[model samples]
Target: MLQLIEEIVYQVTGKNGLTYDTDFVQDLALNSFDVMNIIGKFEDHFDTTIPTRDVWHLHQVKDVIDYLAGRGFTQP
Candidate 1:
């Protein structure tokens, strides 16, 4: 799951390097639109719906991994 999330972040930000602590806004310099697009990609790839209300909580890469994990996502 972490690897998959990293792939999504790389595809969205065009950055090859990232860490679990990396922040989407502060670290990646992604704007609101970019974040939303990434979130959409996440939903599509994971086949899960992340509510808008919970979007703000996804500040870091780990947050996204945690969120999906809580939703029953597991690493292959």
Candidate 2:
């Protein structure tokens, strides 16, 4: 799941070498538009919808993993 998240982020940011500790905004310098794009990709990839308000709560790669886990997403 982390791998897939990393790929999705990379596909949008074109930045690699991400860790679970990587901060989407602080580390990657992602702006709101970029963030929304990433979240959109995540939704499409996982086939689930994420509330816009909740996207703000996902600050790190680990946060994304946990959110998906809560949704019962267990695959990479």
Candidate 3:
């Protein structure tokens, strides 16, 4: 699951050195457009739809993992 998150973040940010603690907006400087793009990719990868409002709640990689877990996406 961690690797999955890493891959997704890397794909979106084009930064392969991301850590779970890395802040999407601060560390990666991911703007609103980037966030939207990331959410879209994550939806496709997880095969689930994430609400736009809820996307703001995700600040770090762990937040994404928890959100996906709530949607029953167990680590592979």
Q: Please report the candidate that would top TM-score against the real structure.
A: 2
Model 2 residue 27 CA deviation (Å) reads: 0.6
Per-model root-mean-square deviation over C-alphas:
1.4, 0.8, 1.4
Off by over 4 Å in 1: none
Q: Pick by lDDT: which candidate is best?
A: 2
For model 3, residues 18-69, the per-residue Cα lDDT tens digits are 7778788888888998889878888898777889999999998778778888
- Report clash pairs, candidate 1: none
* TM-score ranking from best candidate downward: 2, 1, 3
Per-residue accuracy of model 1 over 4-75 as CA lDDT, tens digit each? 877887788787577889888888888888878888998897777889889888898888878877888876
Candidate 2 vs. true structure, TM-score: 0.94
User: Using Cα atoms with residue i matched to residue i, what is each candidate's TM-score against the true structure?
Assistant: 0.86, 0.94, 0.86
Runs with alpha carbons beyond 4 Å of true place in candidate 2? none
lDDT of each: 0.81, 0.89, 0.81
